[model samples]
Every structure is written in C-alpha cells, then in structure tokens.
Target: MATLSAGGQQDAACMHIRELTMNACKVAHSAAGAVAEGIATGVNALLETVRPREIELDRLDREIDSAVTTHITGATEESAREMLACMKLSIGMERIGDLLLGFSNRALVAASRCEMEDVRDLTLMASRLEKMLSEVREAFEMRNLDKALAVLRSDAEIDRLRNLVFVRHLENPGGTHRSESFHVVFMTQALERAGDHVKNMAEEVCHLVSGQSVRHLLRSIDKPLEQMFLDQLRTKHAL
Candidate 1:
C-alpha cells in the first residue's frame, strides 16, 4: 500500500509539469502574435497617410500646369512671375509629398494593407512613378542597393519627358496670341523644375541606399541644365 501511494503521487507531479509546459508555450505564442499585430497596425496607418498626400501632390501639379498655361496666355509680368513662383512652390511641395507617400506605401505593404494596380504604359506613367517612388522609399528604409539603382534609372524617363515639354514650349509657344509667351515660359520653367525635384528625390534614394552623400554629384549632373537656364535668363535680361 505504501508503494502504490508513492507511485500515485509521482504520476500527479508529472501531469502537473506537462500542464505547466503547455500553458507557457501558449502564452509565448500569444505574446509573439500581439507584437506582430502591433507592427502591422502601425504600418497600415503610415501608408494611408502617404497615399492621400501623393494624390494631393498630383492634384497640385495639375493645378500648377493650368495656372502656368493661363498666365502665359494673358497675364502681365508681375502676375506671371507670381504665378511662376506659386508653381515652383507646388513642385517643391509635391516632391515632399512624394517622399511621404513612398514611405507610407512601403509600410502599408509590409503591414499587408492591400494590393495596388499594376499597369505599364505611357498612359500609366504617373502611377508607375508613384510605385517607383514607393519602392525607392522602401529601398531606402531597408538599405536596398538594387532598388535605389532601379529608381535612378527609372527617373531618367521622367527627365526626358520634362525636357520634351520644355522644348515643345520653346519651339512652338503653342498659343496663337503673342502676349502668352511669358506664361508659356513660366510653365516651361515649372515643368523643368519638376524634373529637378524628381532628380533630387532619386539622389536622396541613392544616398539612403548606399550610405553615400550624392548632393554634390546631383549638382554636377545638373550643371548643364542650370547653365542653359542661366544663359536664357541672361539673354532675356539683355533684351
């Protein structure tokens, strides 16, 4: 009877130990899950903030374009310069907006916010640009060299289009009316600066990815454009 009582006590102890082990495992799993969920929530909130800002920047760009077109066609010098300054401000503001969107998009994706549309064409360039910007931001955050390089290459096309727009304005001056030249020039300047802002963002991506400062490099790259603009301004002043 004594031996049997001892065996029974041992069995009870073993069962209790197994129960405690199982409970501990469950608690650990729960804690890990909570941490993951918190991270996901934080990422989603960040992305939503980015998306609306990008959209607003796009809207502002359109507004700048319209203002430039209108002012060039009918406005005086003071009015045109004021409008041009506003357009430049819009370009600067939009670049900042793009950076914010890029950060948010990555965070959202990391958090599993939702899938975005994937289309490729000139018609979809704006969307593509937005996606590329987002990827650039992600690369910067993750220190991804490949993605940063990709963004630099992709921005080349944007530069090309911007130059095309500027050249077109200079070559054609579009409107039948003579008074609109000032406004057209202003629009061309805004478009060119928009390209510069995009280039600046790409340079930032490169810096963030490689841990190298590229501000000087960008300034070097832009020298020709800057010189051309300066020459044009000097010629205008001479006249």
Candidate 2:
C-alpha cells in the first residue's frame, strides 16, 4: 500500500472537495432534469424517469455535507457566510429532489383514479418551476445577482398556481373517487414546495453575490401588499 505523504494528502483532500462540489452541482442538474422530464412525460411516466435518480441525489447530498465540513477552512466573515450559503444550497437541492419524488408518487396515485379538475395550471406550474431550477443553478454557478433576482421573481407565479389549484379543489372536489382530487392537490403542494426550495437557493445565491438579504427587493416589488396592510391598520385605528 502506498501511503500518501503530507502534501499528497492535502492534494488528495482538495481533489475530493472538487469532486464533491461537482457532485453537488450534478445533483442540482439531475433534479432539474427530473423535474423537466417529469413535466414532459406527464403523470404516468414521471416515476419511471424521476424515481431512478432519487438515490443518486441523496448520495450526492451526503458527499456535499462531507465536503463542506472538511474543506471550508477559513475564519473570515465572508468565507463563513459563503460556506453557510453553500450548505443551504445543497439542502435546498435535496429538498427539491424530495418534492419531485413526492410529486411523482402522488401523481401515480391520482393516475390510478382520474384526471385533475384542471391540468392547465398544473402544467404551467411545472414548466415555470423547471425554469426556476435551471436559473437557480446558473445564478449560483455564475454568481449573477440579476439572474438570482429573476429566479426569486419567478416563484410568485408558482404561488399563484398553487392557490388556483386549491380554489379549484374547493369548488368541485367531487368525483367517483372524490379522494382523487386531493392527489392533484398533493401534487400541486409538492410543486409549490419545490418552487419554495428553488427560491431558497436563489436567495442564498443573491446573498453570496451581494452580501445582503433579498427582503428589500421583495418589499419594493410588494408595494400593493404593503398598502393593503397599511389600509387595514388605518381602518382599525379609526374604529
């Protein structure tokens, strides 16, 4: 057995970190591909394409955690924040993989029964989320603040689609298998959660690039919501 000398050991460790980081990146790309293929193949073939990747995703996430712990050796504040962001990004990707798996399972159950009340919104949700995942990966890779902001902005439509599905479910959640509607609901919930994780990753990317939170950007875009709260406060004060 050839023993590694001290410098060789350091080089080996650095190479491990690089491989781990690339695997973390591969997890993100694989999840994104799974999501896109799931959407394209519809509900039935989704598991065939996506389920095969879940175990690999989990393995990549474990590698990422090990790499971050072993490689992120720095005392500066920026470095600390960068490591934190990197960890969050890994967790966010893992959560997205979980959500995609959940989506496939619930959709499979739904398929055994009936179609959704309306699938148009669900289709749109999947498409938008696929785009968001790609943008998140790219923004993080490039550290482009604007691209990160766009990824965050795209999450709003996912939220809207989730709300639409819920409203539709409330209106006509009646079928031979009334429980079937809830499967669609569950699927939408998974997609919504996946979008949330994408947003989380995007926020971390924004933080990495700007060294600041994205809350201010949100507040600026949500002026109408702020005004609505202000109006409610004024009405309460008058009462």
Candidate 3:
C-alpha cells in the first residue's frame, strides 16, 4: 500500500467535508419532497418517506462527525472556515427536517378532509417552501448572497399564503372540526417554520460570503403582503 503524504491527507479530508455537505443538502431537499408527496398522495406515503429519509440524515450526520474528528485538527484558516460553515449548514438542514416532522401527523389528517380550496392553498404553500429549499441549496453551492437574499424575501410570501389559509378556514368555520382546527394550524405553521429554517440557512450563506450577519437586513421594514394576515389572525384567536 502507498503511504499518503500529510498534504494529501488534508486534501482528502476537505473533500470528505464537501461530500458531507452535499449529502446534508440532499437530506433537506428530501424532507421538502416528503411534504409535497404527502400532500399529493396521503399521510401513509408521506410517513414512509419521512422515516427512511430521517435514517439517511442520521447516517450523514454521523459521517460528518467522523470526518470533522479526523481532519479538523490543525487545519489552515480557509479550510477551517469551510468546515465550520458546512457544519452550520448541516445543522440548519437537520432542523428543517425536524420542523417538518413536527406537524406531519396533523397535516396528514387535515389533508384528507380539508376543502379543495384549502388543499389548493396548502399545495401552493408547500411548493413555495420547496422552492426556498432549492434556492437555499443554490445559495450555499455558489456562496451567492443574492440567492440567499431571495430566499429571505420569499419568506414574506410563505407568510402570505399561510394567512390566506387561515382566512379561508375562518370564514368557512368548523370545516374540519372544532378541535381539528389545530390540524390546519399545524400544516400552515409547518410551512412557515420550514421557511424560517430555510431563511436561517440563507443567513448562513450570507455570513459565509460576506463575513457579516444579514439576519436583520431590511427583510421586513413594513408588514408584507398586507395588514390582512394580522387581522385574520387576531379575529381567529378572538373567537
């Protein structure tokens, strides 16, 4: 066997980190897809997809741990930055998965019984969330601040769609059930939370590219969409 030189070992480790980052991104995308599939098919299919994907994500997380352990020692400044950024990105992705799982059970029940328009609204929301996942992936891949900002901007639309769902549900009243309104709430909240997590990953991209936090960078100087969402939310809570 040929003995590897010290420099060659470092190169291999950096490559491993890159691979782990790619796998982490794939896991996030898969989680988004699970919601889409669940909406298109039913809860059972969504549940199946989520369970296996979680196993894959757990496997990748372990691999990242092992790689970080082996090669992170005495790394150069640039390589260290890459490792740390990728680690944060992996975490953001994992949390997105967890958030998606949080409301899946309730969403499954709601999906089966909600009105066609409500279902349509939710399907649109899920598509938007999935697109955010794609943009966040691109932003990280290219280290592009613009793409990340776009992801940030997209959050407003997610909030808008969520509001639409709430307004329609409120107008109709007990469309699902009294207690089961929570089901609709969970589904919408899942989209909003998913968008927030995607925004977190986008902020990570901003930091990696600019060495500054853009988390507070004029994302919402004004209430986006309209005052209607807050109005809807207040009215719903009041009743």
Weakest lDDT window of 10 consecutive positions for candidate 1:
114-123
**lDDT of candidate 2 over 1-97, digit per residue (tens):** 9898755655565556445544665665665555555554554665556666666767767876776676566424555566557677777777777
lDDT of 3 by residue, 1-239 (tens): 99778777877787788788887787778777777767766666774576566667667766776787778897777777777777777777766777667656667556677666666666777778888888888887888877887787777788888887776656655465433455777788877887888878788888778777673443433444234345545787999
Per-residue lDDT tens digits of candidate 1, residues 48-142? Answer: 54455456556656655564654344444434443443454445446545544443344344323221211111112343344444544455345
Deviation of model 3 at 74, angstroms? 0.8
TM-score of 1: 0.34
Q: Which candidate would rank higher by TM-score, 1 or 3?
A: 3
Better of 2 and 3 by TM-score: 3
Which residue pairs show collisions in model 3? none
Model 1: CA > 4 A from native: 1-95, 98-125, 173-195, 214-239
Candidate 2, residue 194: the lDDT equals 87
Query: Please, what is the whole-model Cα lDDT of each candidate in the order they appear?
Result: 0.44, 0.69, 0.73
Model 3, CA-based lDDT: 0.73
